[model samples]
Target chain A: MGRTLAEKVWDAHVVRQGEGEPDLLYIDLHLLHEVTSPQAFDGLRLSGRPVRRTDLTLATEDHNVPTTPGPITDPISLTQVHTLRRNCEEFGIRLYPMGDAEQGIVHVVGPQLGLTQPGMTVVCGDSHTSTHGAFGALAFGIGTSEVEHVLATQTLPLKPFRTMAITVDGELADGVSSKDIVLAVIAKIGTGGGQGYVLEFRGSAIRALSMEGRMTVCNMSIEAGARAGMIAPDETTFAYLEGRDHAPRGEDWDAAVASWRELHTDEDAEFDAEVVIDASELTPFVTWGTNPGQGAPLSHSVPDPATMDDTERQSAERALEYMGLVAGTPLRRIAIDTVFVGSCTNGRIEDLRAAAAVVKGRRVADGVRMLVVPGSARVRLQAEAEGLDTVFTEAGAEWRLPGCSMCLAMNPDKLAPGERSASTSNRNFEGRQGKGGRTHLVSPLVAAATAVRGTLSSPSDLEPLEPLVPAADLAHQEA
Target chain B: MDAFTTHTGTGVPLRRSNVDTDQIIPAEYLKRVTKSGFEDGLFAAWRKDETFILNDPTYAAGSILVAGPDFGTGSSREHAVWALMNYGFRVVVSSRFADIFRGNSGKAGLLTAQCSQDDVELLWKLLENEPGTSVTVDLVSRTITAGDVVAAFDVDEYTRWRLLEGLDDISLTLRHEPDITAYEQLRPAWKPVTG
Candidate 1:
C-alpha cells in the first residue's frame, strides 16, 4: 500500500513512537502571537526550562496591536504585547514588534518571509495557523499548554489524525473564487463534518488556484472542523517559494524542490473518508447564520427553518433571530452596515487587487462604511505600490495598516452592537467580530461590491454608474 | 493537573449546537495574560439574557455541561477550557466535540465524555425534566449515569490513562530528549530557521 501525503509527513516527523503511546512529532516551526503565548512563556519560566529551539520559534504582536497607529491604548492589550516582547527577548526568540515591517498576523508573516515551506510541521497558538498548510506542511493549532510543551521540548506527542480527501473538480465560473468554493464545501459538509481528519484538497480546481487563493482555502480548514488542510506541492508552489527571503538558495533550492516533488500522495493511497464537490456548480456563496455551514448562494433566498430537521430547525431559528433576518428574503437584498476586506484568510495583495478592481471608479454606498486592512505590512506596501490604496480610499473606504483587525476584534477595530457586515475573513460564529455583531462571510469581490450597494452582492450585480458628462461639454456640443 | 477517575455534579443542559469558543469566552476576555479568572466571560453574551440557563437558580451550581452535538467547534482558544473550569465545570457530555477542544479539555483535566446521539438526547431530556438531577461521569467504567438512565461513553485510551494518572505531558516528552536530538541532526539543511 502506498502512503498518503499526510501519512508520509507524519511518519517523517516522528521522533518517537511506542506501544500505547502517542507519537512524538518534531516541530519545524512555531509561530506565536501576544494573545496565547504569555501563559506558555510563564509556564516555561516556572518550570525553570529554557526554550529548546529558539531558531525554529518566532513571535509577533498582532492580535492586540492597534491597526490605526499610535501606541497600544488599551492597558490590558498593551501589557499582553509588552509581555510577549519581554518574553521573546528573555528567551532569545525572534520578536516582531508592532511597528516592525515584518510584524503582522503570524500566519501571513510566516509565508511572506518564506519561513513556511513544504514537508514541514508548523504549530501556532492561533486556529488560523492552518493557513501555512498551503505549502504541503502538516500545520495545526495548539492550545497554551501544548504551546508550552513545544517551547520546552520542541516536540508534541500527538495521536495520528485520520485522513480525508476533499476533491473539488471542474473550473469555477468567472465571478466565483476560492472563497466561494470553500464556503460551498462547508455548507455541504457542515462545520463538524471534517472532525478528526486532515483534509487534502485535491483535483482540478484546487490545482488551478494561485498561491494566495490556495492559502485562503486552506486557512479555513479549521472552520470545517479539520485539524489541518493541505495541498500537495507542485510547480506553482515551487514558483512562489523560488526567491523568497528564507527559501533555500543556489544548489540547496534544487535539492529542496526534488524532495518537495515527492510530497504528493501516491497513486494507490487511500483516505479514511472522501468528499467530492463540483466547482462548476458553485456560485457566489455567503453565510446566512451564525456558523460557517449556514450558507446559501447569493442568488438564493434565506432558507425557512420549517423546511429543516428538528435540530437544524432549532439552530436555524436561533441563527435567524440573532442575524435579524427573515426567511424568503433574497440574499442579494440583505442590507449590511459595514464591509471588512482583510484577514489572514483574504488579506494578501491579490485579495486587495480584486477589491480594488471593483471599486476603482465607484463610491461606497451612502450608509455603508468600508475598511480595507492588509494582512501584513509587506502586503500593505505591495498594495500601495500598485495604487490599490488610492483606488480604495478614493472610493470612500478606509485603507488601514496590517493586523488581524475586525476579524477577531481583539484590538480597537470592532463592530458596534447590532451592526452587520459583509466580511472577507473566515468564521461567521456568533460574536466573532464583536458582541452582537452579525457577519456574512464572502469573497473579496463580494465584499467590495456589497460596499458599493449597501447590500450583499457580487461584482456581476453592480451596474456601471452613468458616465459623467460635463455641462460645459454638453453646451459646446449643442452649439 | 488533577487525576479524574470520576465526577458527580448537577447538569446544565446547553441546548445549542456549534457552541464555538467565541461564545464560550469572547475575544475581549482573551486580552488577559493569566489563564484563570475567566468565569465571568463564559457565555458572556448569552448570560446577558436574564432567562439564560446559567442564570436560572436550578443549574447555578452545576459542574457538568450536557450540551448539544458539535460542542466547542471553532477557534483554538484554550480560554474556553479555562472559562468552563473557572465557572466550575468538570465534565462536558456531548455526541461530538471538535478535535482541538477535546485535546484542550484533556490537558486541562476536564473530562469530555462522548456518547451516542440518542444517549445524549436522553441525558438532555433527563437533566431538563429534572432540573437539578445529579449526573455521575465514571471514567473507570466509561459510563454516564443519571436517574434510571445509564449509558456508555468513549474516550481515547492514552488520554484516559493520562487523566487517571494525572501525568504531565512536558515531563513525559522530556524523557525522550535523546531521540529528538538525533532526529534534529538528520534534518535537511534547506529547512528555514527563524533567526
Candidate 2:
C-alpha cells in the first residue's frame, strides 16, 4: 500500500521504532515563546542538560509582549519575557527580542524566516503551532514537559496519529474565503470529531487558496480538536519559500523542491477517516456560541436549541446564555463592540491587504473600535510599505505593531466584560479573549466590513461607496 | 512525575460540555513562570458564581472531576493541568477528551480516564445526587468504581505503563542517543537551521 503524506513525514523523522513501543521522532525545528518555555528551560537547568540542537531551536517574545511601542508595563509579562531572553542567552539558542525586527508570534516568525519547510517536523508550545503544517510538515503542539524533552533530546516518543482526509472541492464564491470554509467544516464536524487524528486538507478548493489562506486554515485545526493539520506541498508552497531568509539556496533549492514534491499522499493511499466539503455551498460563516463548532452562516438566523438533540440542545442553551443571544434573531442584526484583525491565523500581509481593501473608503461605525495588529514585525513593515497602514488608520482603525494582541489577550489588548467582537483570530471558546468577552470568528474581509457596520456582517453586506469626482471633473460637468 | 496506580476521592460533577483550557485556567493566570501555585486560578471565572459545584462545601475537597464530554478542548497550555493538580484534582473522568489535553495530563501525572457516555451519565447522577460521593479510579484494573456502580474505562497500553511505572520520557529517549545522531547525519543538507 502507498503511504499518506503524514505517514511519509512521520516515517522519515523516526529515530527509533520498536514493536509495542511508541516511535521516537526527531524534530527538525522547535519554536518557543515566553508563556510555555520558562518551565521547560527550568527543567533543563535542574537536570543539568544543555540544549541538544541550538541551531534547530528558535525562541521569540510574543505572547507577553505589548504590541504598542514602549516598554512592557505589566510586571508579570515583563518577567516572562525577560526570563525567555535570559534562558535563550544561557542556552545558546537564537532569540528575537521584543524590539527586534524579527520579533513576532512564533508561528508567524517560523514561516516568514523560511525555517518551517516542507517534510520537516515542527514543534511548539502554543496550540497554533499547527500553523506551520501548511508546508506539508508534521507539526503539533507539545506541553512544557514534552518541550523539555525535545530541548534535551531533540526527539519525542509519540504514538502514531490516525490520518484523516478533509477534502474540500469546488471553487469558493465571490466573498467566501478559507476562514469561512474552515468554519463551515468545524460546524459540520462537532468539536471532538478530529481528536487523535492529523487532518490532511486536500482537493481543489484547498489548492486554490494562497499560502496565507492555507496558514489561516491550518491554524484553527486545533479548534476542531485536531492536534495538527497539513496540506501537501506544491508550486504555491515552493514559490513562497524561494528567497526567504533561511530558504535553501543555489543548487540546494532544486534538491529541496524535488524532495518536497514527493511529500504528498500516493494515489492508492488510504485514510482512517474522510470528510468531503463543497466549497461552493459555503457562505460567510461565523460562530454564534462559545465553541467554534457552534456556528452558522452569516445569512442565517441564530439556531433554536430545541431543534437539536438532548446533549447538543443543552450545550447550545448554555452557549446562548453566555453569548447573550436570542434565538430567531438574524445574525446580521447582532451588534459588536470591537473588531480585531490580527493573530497567527490572519495577521499576514495578505490578510492586511484584504482588510485594507474593504476599509479604503468606509469609516468605522460610530462606537465600534477596530485594531489591525500585524502578525510579525516583517508583516507590519510590509503592510506599511504598501500603504495598508494608512488605509486602516485613515479610516479610524488602530494600526499597531506585531505580536499576538487580542487573540489570547495575554497583553494589554483585551475586551471588557460583556464586550463583543468580530475577530479574525481563531477560537471562540468562553473567555478566550478576556473574561466575559464574546467573540465571533471571522475572516479579515468580514472583520473589516463588520467594523464599518458595527454588526456581524460580510463584505457583501457593505454597500459600494459613492465615488468622489475631482474638482476639474465637476467643473467640466457644470460647463 | 509521580506514579499514579490508583486514587480515591470525592467527585465534582462539572455538567458543562466543551470545558476548554481557557475555562480551566484563564489566560491571565498563565503569566506566571512557575508551574505551581495555580490553585487560585483554577476555574477562576466560573468560581465567581456562588452556585458553582466547586463552591459547594460538600465537593470542596473533591480530588476527582467528572466532567461532560470534550473536556480540555482548546489551547496547549499545560497550565490547565498544573492548575487542576494544584486545586487538588488527581483524576478527570470524561466520556471524551481532547488529544493534547489527555497527553499533557499523562505526563503531569493527572489521570484522564475515558469511560462510555452512559457510564459518565451514571457517574454524574450518582455524584450530583449525593455530593461528596466517593469515587475510585484504578489504573491497574482500568476501572472506575462509585458506590457499587463500577465501570470499566479505556486507556492505551503504553501510556498506562508509563504512568504505572512513573517513567521519564526524556531519559527514555536519551537512551537512543546513538540512533538520533545517526539519523541527524543522514538528514538532507538543504534543511533549514535557525542559526
Candidate 3:
C-alpha cells in the first residue's frame, strides 16, 4: 500500500528502526516556551550535555508573560520567564523575549518566522505544537524529558502512530470558519476518538482554507486526543511561506516549493481509520459544555440529556451542570461575561481582520468585557499599521499585546471564579482558563458578535459592519 | 529515571474519564524552575474537597492509580508524570490513555498500562471494595492482579524494555547520531532551517 502523508514524513525522519524497538527519529526543530523548558534545561545541565543543535532550537517567553506592556507582575510567572532567558543564554539557543517583535505564542511565532516548514519533524513542550503540522510537518508535543532529550540529542525515540483521514467536502457556509469545522469534527468523533492516531485532514474543505485557517484546524488536534494533525502542503502553503523572514529566497524558494509539492498522500495511500464531515452542513459552531467536543451549531439548542444515549446522557448532564446551562437551553441565548478574541488558535492577522470586519460599527455590550490580543508583537504592530487596534478599541475591546494571555491563564489575564467567556482559545477543560471560570470556544467572528450582544451571537445577530469608509468621510456622514 | 521492575502496592481507583493533565498538575504549579517536588501540587485543585481519592487516609499510601478511560487527556506537561511519580505512583492503569501522557509516563519511568474497559472496571471495583487493596503489577509477565481480580495488561515492548533497563532516551538516540547526520546531509539545500 502507498504510504500516507504522515507515514511518508515519519519514514523520512527515522534514523533507525528495529523490529521490536521504537523508531529513533531525528528532530528538525525544537520550539520552547517558559513553563515547560526550565526543567528540561536543568536536566541538560545536570547531565553536562550541551544542546546538540542550538541553531535548530528556539525559545520564546510565552505562557506566563503578561500581555500588558509592562514587566511580569506575578512572582511565579516572573521567575519562570527569567529562568527561560537564563537557560536560553546559557545554552546559546535563540530566544524571542517578551516585547520582541518575534515574541508571541510559540505556535504562532514558528510559522510566521518560517521556522516551521513542510516535511520537517517539529517538537515542542506545549500541546499545541500540532499547529505547525499545517505546513505538512510531522510535529507533535513532547514532555519536558523529551524536550531535554531533543535538546541534548536532536532525535526522539518514537512509537509509530496510526494514520487517520478526516475528510470534509463542500464549501463552508457564510460566517462558519476553520474553528467551526474543527469543533464539528471533534463533536462527531468524541475526545478519545483519535487516540494513537495522526490525523491527516484531507478533501476539498481542507484544501480550500487559507494557511492561517489550516493552522487553526490543526492547532486543536490534541483536543480530539490526537497527538498531531496535518494538512498536506500545497500552493497556498507555498505562497504563505514564499517571503517569510526565515523562508528560502529566490531560486531556493522555487526548489523548496518543488520539494513541498511532493508531500501529499499518494493516490493509493491507506489510512487506518476515516471520518467524513459535510462542510455545507456546518454552521456557526459553539461549545455549550465544558469540553471542546461538547459543541453543536449555534442554531441547535443545548442537547437534551434525555434524548442522548446512556453514556452520553450522563456526560451531558455533568457538562451542563459545570457550564451553568439547562439541558434544553438555546445555545444562542447563553450570555457571556467576557469575549476574548485571541490565542494561538485564532490570534493570527487573518483572524484579527475577521473580527475587525464584524465589529467596525458596533460597541461591546453594556456589561461585557472584550479583550483583543494579538498573537505576537509582530502581529500587534501589523494590526496597528492596519488600524485594527483603533477599530477594536472603538468597539470597546481592550487591545493588548500577545503572549498566550488567558488561554491557559498562567499569566495575569485570567477569568475570575464563576465568570463565563466566549473565547477563541483552544481547550475548555475544567479550570483551564481559571479556577472556576467557564469558556465557550468560538471563531473570531463569533467572538466579535458575542462581544456586541453579550450573548453567544453570530454575525446575523448584529448590525452589519459597514463597508470601508475613510476616517474623513465617517465624520462628514455623522453630520 | 529509576528502573521500574515489579511493583506491588495498594491501588486507588479514580473513576473519572478525561482526567486531563491540567487537573493532574495545574498550569499555576507549572511555573517551578525544576521538575522535582511536584508532589505537593499533584491534583492541587481537586485536593480542596479533602475527599478526593488521593487524599483519603485509606488510600494515602496507594502507589497505583486505577482510572477510567481517556486518562491524562490534555497537555503535554511531563510535569504531570513527575507529579504522579513524586506522589509515589508506580503505575497508572486506565482503559485508555492519551498518547502524549502515556509517552511522558514511559519517558519518566512511570508505567502506563492499558487493559480492556471490563478489566479496568473490575480493577476499580476491587480497589474501591477493598480500600488499600494491594494489586501486584508484574511487568515481566505484563499482568495486574489483586484478590479475586486479575487481568492481563499491555505495554509496548520498547517502553517495557526501557522501563526495565532504566534506559535514557537521549543516550539511546545518540548512539545513532551518524545516521541522523547522514540524513541531514541528504536534505534539499532549499529546505528552510531554524537559527
Candidate 4:
C-alpha cells in the first residue's frame, strides 16, 4: 500500500500501535505558555509526577503578557506572569520571560530559535503549534490534561488521521502572495474541509514559495480543519535552516540536509483525498460571512440567501443582517467599520511592509478604526526600523504593541457588539473578534486598502504610488 | 464528573472545517466561570436563525454530534467541550479530531470518536437527509454505529475506563492515596509539583 507524506511521518513517529487503540507516540518537544499550562502543572502536582524531561520542555509567557515593554498594569496579568515565572523556575524548565529579546509568541520563537527543526514531534498547549509543521515535523496542540500527559510521560496516545493533498498548481499572479493563496484555499475548502486529515500542500506552486511564505501557509492549516499542513523540506527549507541558532552547524548541516531531502512524498504515494487549485485563477479574497470559509473574491458580490442551501439560507440572511450588508451587492462595496492588520497569521515584518505600502500616503477612512499590531517584539522592532509603524500611524491607524491582540479578544483588544472588521487573522467565526462583532478575512494589503476605503478592497483596487521618502528625509522636509 | 450516562437524540451534521472552540462557545460565555449552564451559548453565533440546525425543532433534542474532520481545532478552551456536553451532545464523531479537543472532550466525559473520512461523510450525509436518525456511540467498544456502518475508533485505555466509570482526575488520584503519598515523600521539599 502506498503512503502519503502524512502516513510516512506518522509511521516514523509511531512507538506502539494496537488494534482499536490509539498509538503512543513519543513527543520530542513540549512548549508551554501561561494560559494553558497552569492547570496541566497542577495536574502533575496532584499526581505527584515530576516533569519527565525538563530539557525537552520550554516555557514562555505570551497570551497574558502585556504587549507594551513596560511592566504589566493589570493586577491579574501581573499575577499570571509571576505565576508562570515561579512555576518554570521551580520546575527547572527554561523560560523566555517577557522583555527577553528572544521572547515572542511561542510559535514564532520556536522556529526563529531553530528549535522547530524537521522530524520532531512538537506539542504545545496552543493551537498554532501547527505553525511548526512547515519545517516538516508532526506538531499539534494539546489540552491541559494532555499537556500534563506530555510533561509527565513525554508522550501522547493519538488516533491516526487520513491524508489529504492540497495541490495549488500553476504560478501565482503578481502581488498574490502566500497569504492570499492560503485565504483562497480556506475559502474554497471551507472551514471543515480538511478535518480528520493531514494536508500535504504540494505541486509546483508550493515548491516555489519561500520558507517564510510556507510557514505563513502552514500556520493557518488548523483554521481550515486540517491536523497540520506541511510542505516537503527542500533547498528553500535548507537555506532557511542554514544559519539559525539551533539548526545543525557546519558538517552536521550537510548531514541534516541529506536526511531532510528525503522527507518528501515518494512518487508512488497515495492520498485519501486531493484538492487541486489553479493558483493563477485566485484573487485577493475576503469573507462576507462570519467564517474564514465564507470568503469570495473581492470583486464578487455578497451572496444572497435565497440562492443558498436550505440549511444555510437563514444563517446567510442573519449574517447579512448583522454585517449590515445587502444581498447581491458587490463585496468590494461592503463598508467596513474597522481594519485590523495583525495576528499570528499576518503579523510578520513582510506583512507589515505589504500593508504599509498601500496605506503610506492615503489616510484611512474617517469613520474606520484601524489598528496595526505586530506578531512579536522582534517583528515590531523590524517594522519600526523599516518605519512601517509611522506609515500606519500617519495613515490614521493606531500603532499597537505585540501579542495576540485583535486576532482574538483574549486581551484588551476586542470588537464591540455589532461592529465589523476587516482582519488579517485566520478565523472569522461570528464574534471571533468580539461578541456580535463580524469579521472579514483578508490579506494585509487588503486590510490596509479596506482601512482606506472603509470597505472590503484589495490592493489591486488601489493605484500604485511613488515609493515613500525615508523617515529621515521626511523629517528633514518637515523641519 | 458523573458517569455511565447514556445519550440519545437526533444528530445534526456540521460539515465545516476548523470549527474551533471559539465558534463552539464564544469567549463572552466564558465571562461566567460557572461551567454548568453554558448550553445556551453553544454555537450561539450560528443561532442567528430561528431555524438554525441546533435551534431547529427537528434536531433540537439531538445529543450526538456528527462533525467533519479535524472537528475541533484551535484553542484548548474546555468551554467548548463543556458547551457541547451541556448542549446535550454526548459524542462527537469526526474523521479526524484535534488533540486538545479530544482530550478536553474525554475529560468532560464526552466521547470523541475518530472514524475514516468516508464513514464520517456517509453518516453526515445520512443525518443531513434524515434528521431524526439516531447514531449510537459506544465508548466501551470504541465503536460508532449508524444504520449501515460500524466504525471502530481509538481512545486511550485510561480515558475510556474513566469515562465508563464516571471518574475524574481528582477522584482517580484519590483512589490511590498510598502510592501518591509515597511518591510525594520520596521527592525532596525543594522539588514541588503543582497540579
List DockQ, one per candidate, in order.
Answer: 0.88, 0.87, 0.77, 0.20
lDDT of 1 by residue, A227-334 (tens): 999999999999999999999999999999999999999999999999999999989999999999999999999999999999899999999999999999999989
Ranking by DockQ: 1, 2, 3, 4
Which residues of candidate 2, in runs, are more than 4 Å off? A470-479
Name the better of 3 and 4 by DockQ. 3
Error (Å) of candidate 3 at residue A218 is 0.6
TM-score for chain B of each model, two decimals: 0.98, 0.98, 0.97, 0.86
The model with the greatest lDDT is: 1
**Model 3 docking category:** medium
Candidate 1 Cα outliers beyond 4 Å, as residue runs: A465-479
True contacts kept of 3: 0.79
Best by DockQ: 1
Cα lDDT of model 3 by residue, B1-195, tens digit: 678889999899997778889889888888888768999889887888787887889998989999878899889999999999889999999989999999889888899989998998898888888898899999999999899888899999999999999998888887777887887787677665566
Put down candidate 4 lDDT per residue, A180-247, tens digits, no spaces.
Answer: 88888877786667766778888888889877778788888877777788887877877777787777
- For candidate 2, write residues A3-87 as lDDT tens digits: 9999999999999998889999999999999999999999999999999999999999888777788999999999999999899
lDDT of 4: 0.76
**Interface RMSD list for the candidates:** 0.7, 0.8, 1.3, 7.4
